[model samples]
Target: MSVSVRTRALTAADGTLSHRYMALRSLMKICVKRRSVVTFLALFTLSVVLINTIPLLPKETMRLPPRDLKGSTSKRLPAGTPSTLLDLPPPLNGHKNKLFSGSSAIPFKQPLSHSVKAPVTSQAAKTLNSSNSTRLCQQKCIRDGGGHASVAVGEAEMTQQTVREVSGEETAHERKPDSFWKRRSHSFAGKESIPRDRMRGEKSDLCQISVGKWNETTPESLPWLSAGDVRKMAFLSGGVVLSKARVPGHGQVLQVGLGAGEAEAEAEAVLDHRQHCQSGSCALIKRPSDWFEVLAFHLDRVLELNRSLPSVLRNFKSKLLPYRYISGNARPVVWWDPDIQHLAEVDNDQNSFSLSWPLYQKVLQSRCGARVSLNATPCVGVQHSEWGRLALFDFLLQVNDRLDRYCCGFRPDPSDICLENLLHVKCKSPNDLLLVHILVRRADPSRLVFIDNAGRPHHPHDNLNFRLVEGIDEFPERAVSILRSGCLESMLLRSLSADRELWESRGGAEGLRPIIRTIQQRGTILLQHIQNRILRLNKDL
Candidate 1:
């Protein structure tokens, strides 16, 4: 019996061991079958973990190489190098620009009568220098927050390709050298040294033609709340001196709110000629106490037009405004704030393009359906919006010196003007050109205040009848009915109020009749002109 038990135990052990061996063999077979997929998954997980663990690095900053004004744009100058566009004549054939690429010109201003010389390299540089001068200036302007900027593109690599989706008739150019910047835009591009009179400094003892004797009072005493208040305050104050009411072309632009170097851009207009004024033109201190400015404001207000920029005639003096006319032809030149004259041009892209006053004039002069670009979007020059209303404003005021005028001081050519005439402008997009109702949505309201209402001819025939406005006919009754009304005298007198003698050479009430009559006669002529234009338009259509 003991022998039988031992034999049974040994057999059971052998059977159990055989079962374990079979299970282990089956597991090995399963592992071998799925090995490829498992191995792939393991490798993928490892890669993902590694990728997640690695830190992302910041973008590397690229410092622009110094400029080589010589035809070659690729070469870099040594550190701390000083160079200028005037250093080398621009190549006769346009070269690559450092800041702007492609063949587009960076627009600059020339006085209305002045034609700037295209003397640089007769060849324009295709590439803009990113570091040193023009390019740097553009970059700085863009960084000012309200300005626009573009990515630096190399001209050698870019060819002009028309994008079809831009709509309308025109395609945008990239500040091309061939079209816009025929001449260097820098303030010092053509010359050197910012002479003192040409310099934008403060004036003291501003020359004033005081009509009545009054105690001296501070400019702060003047309330800018309304036209009457402003005139009243200016009248109560002693006649302070006014000085240097001259710009390159228009002598009417007087300095008021801003002083020399108040803004870096303003300083540049003084220091460099190429740095165009923020406004294509400069600011002026217009005298509404003369009431022409107030008259304009009142007319626009009653007419519900856009010509008024809130103005106050205040007697103030600055160090730069130190010229006091003791005698002679010096009249108290009117003073207005160019700063608050909410008229800024919407230059889409060309760094301060609207500042190129004459260039835009050329654009305006282009046929009615002319097209341009702002922010790479195609913007057509149609006679349908606020731009058209400006013509009416100019027509009413008899303003001859619009953008172009003969300049004075150092750069005395008609191409240049004193910094005071430099306008304050901002950029606009093609999107801003909506229906007149939505025009204010995407665009800044163009309060084109015609502060330079000085020197308007007493008779309209001298100004209104001879020259015609561009888009005058297209404006509707809402825009023009005020010009035709009999209430113009009331409007003028209302604005003049207690300071009625200031309107004309102090003949008191009798002096006002002819001026009012002249305005009424001009209104009749303006209506005739508009009717004629509409009739002609019907014929053309």
Candidate 2:
């Protein structure tokens, strides 16, 4: 019985051992499947502990790689450190700072804290803590440059401040810079803003050419200098007269032969035996005041008007000229260009056309010669821009002989040709008034040649001929800009100095000051008018 009992117990014990071994094998298989998850959790816990403990370590142990390393790396300032505006880091010796990479950002050694006392705004604080600091540096650098490279720091700051003020004014609609470059500074401003490529070295415009001191080989400028060629003067034989009317000193200008049988190349000498007067008018045909013509020519060239005929004051021996109009005094000789196309005597006055004042206004509105059109009623073969140019030239120097020959713009003196000829009486019927001295060259049909430019320099300012600019809405941007530039005086003086005869006749610099001052005053008034018009246009828009 004991043996049977012991065998049963042993069987039970063996069964228990088999079940335990099987359970152990299952547990080992489960552990092998979850081994990766267990390892990941262990690593994550380790990292959390390390991250929390890092701030407790000494700063010396947090040192970055050596500064000599070529690799790109940013060295951030310690937390809670105070940094002033524009306080830049020292430049790395051999490596480019990632902050200023690929940019011309100027890093000032001085900080903004030295000058600016305002507390840093929240936006600036955010910028300091972020990468936006790089952009801020770039903008500051551009401001320092003053739209040009290598500007001095002191000047750059002043220029930058001025630019900001100008920008503020623009935003307020007070005024705006006419040019893109002008927004940064005024010194580089231009009327017809030249392209960057074209602005290299210096502008090659007519104004620029008029600059520089003159030498003997080149007196005044090209085309104005007569090359000192001697010629023979003679009266037209057979008692022939070009016109029925007789002018001041000489009834008619004597034709001087430039070369044998070259009648086409012959130029006319306007004889004036009277003592040279600085101001006042002459006869209807010629200027009795010879100095005025010479002054007008220089003024024309200096202003880059390029409209008046080239005239020079030359002293003539009484014997050299025709005996009929003998004068030993200096006279202006005008180039009688064959290229000019003169109107017939039947066309109103022999020197001009029969267009009435109302018709003139209509023509300006039509914009003649701008483009080809079937309608020819308003097309006068003259460019639309030419009228604006003419108005501006006439307003300055107060030359009213062309546009306001009837003395309609201002009060005329008793001795004035317009009043003496009863021309002002025609102003009552302005629609019947005719235009004169509006000459143009056959070669350039669209441009006008300004002749008989007898400017009234002594005209009273209160009596300025505003009627000259009556129908004109737009002026040449280049001319208007020049008027506003304040350089007109200097430029005119430089150009006029080249003409030895004209310069000396006016008694040099001191004598020329008054005339220049008058022109400048008129320029200021015109500029104000232009600004008002521009503002009016903007409001209409």
Candidate 3:
């Protein structure tokens, strides 16, 4: 039995060994297959990398000319030209006279006075005199050139002498004084000539000659003057008319021309003359009606301000006066006022007067020193919460009472008063807090309720949780849409937190953790309110 057990154990051991050899061979085959797969993957990855890197290598090489060639070429040529050297033609000889012949004959030196020669003959002299006179007179006034005046006087004398020789008849026409003064006066009025010798009294008669009569009388009087009488008169008067003829009624007519009620044609002529005249005495006069119109407009605005004072006072008290109830730790809010002293008195509660119609009239009188117009229309008044109403009544009564005592004055027209527009009052005093009040009014076009700060519109829907304080009235549609959309919460949070780096570096209001936390909490509530409102609206729709 022991031998048979031994044979069976040996056979089992051989079978177990054969099984272990087969498993070992299979394991080797799997390892070989895995190694081959890994090797193939590694080789494939390296080829891809090399293929990608090949295009990055440089494709071209450049060669430059030698330094000596470059330097020699640059030195021999002008800048920007190709640097090629070349031979030139020989210089010309015996051309000295050709260079200097043409311009040498003309002398450039100034001639001496005595060396200047006269015209050769009497005809030439006459020609020269006439030509010089004509050139001197070229569109210039007779008074501008003394040479032309002298020539004109000589020609006139010569003409008179020739006329006396030809006619020889002395008549009453010849005895009459010449109309030269009348002509001069008319021409001077037209600014075509200058009136000279006014202060010397020699031209006094000429000045008295009326511009209007001169234009009419010249043609009628010319036939009465005889040539011999004119020559004798000219000889006695230095060959020129000295004393001007006295024209009847000329002074009265000239006075009438200067006075009001002149015809439009005459006035226009006078204005044209005045505009062109070199004299500094003439000036443009402003009309009385225009001046009155400007004054009326200015006073009208002042009156508007005066009439609107009661409303503004009421609004101020209702909307802004309660800011005093806020905690001392709250952010400092400033109010600007036209009168600092009056504002202080009101703030201190020194005035506790009740506001009534009679009191309003008295307060308006005391502040503006003018009667309020009964015809003035009232602006839309404030719609207030309970807190707002109590605050406003107290504020208005205080302001009114203070105005009755300490305020300087109020404007006649509130529209023109533009308290905020004034430089001295702009956002300066506590009473000026009117700037923050948002006034609600009826829109001109859409007739919707509008809220405005000062005069600018603010959108109410922009901040849904934002309660309109007593003074605010105008709200924009876009702002309302934003609030309805529930986007303002995220916007407010981002705006408040965005300047973190600046806050950290400067140590400003960023450290006010309580205010920041309050704002964040308020934003969350606002968002929830907006969402709820939107859902309700959607359900209703």
TM, every model:
0.35, 0.52, 0.15
Candidate 3: 10-residue stretch with minimal lDDT: 306-315
Best by TM-score: 2
> What is the Å distance of residue 33 in model 1 from its true position?
99
Better of 1 and 2 by TM-score: 2
Please, what is the whole-model Cα lDDT of each candidate in the order they appear?
0.34, 0.47, 0.24
Clashing pairs in 2: none
Off by over 4 Å in 2: 1-217, 220-253, 259-288, 318-328, 346-352, 371-375, 535-541
Ranked by TM-score from best down, the candidates are 2, 1, 3
5 in model 2: Cα distance from truth in Å?
99
lDDT score, candidate 2: 0.47
Query: What's the candidate order when arranged by decreasing lDDT?
Result: 2, 1, 3
Q: What's model 1's overall lDDT?
A: 0.34
lDDT of 3 by residue, 442-511 (tens): 2221111111111111112222212111121111212222222222222222222222322232243333
lDDT digits (tens) for residues 472-495 of candidate 2:
655554455345333455556655
Q: Write the per-residue lDDT of candidate 1 for residues 261-342, one digit (tens) a residue.
A: 3354344434322122232222344433344554555455434453454433334434555344222222333334223322
Superposition TM-score, candidate 1 onto the true structure: 0.35
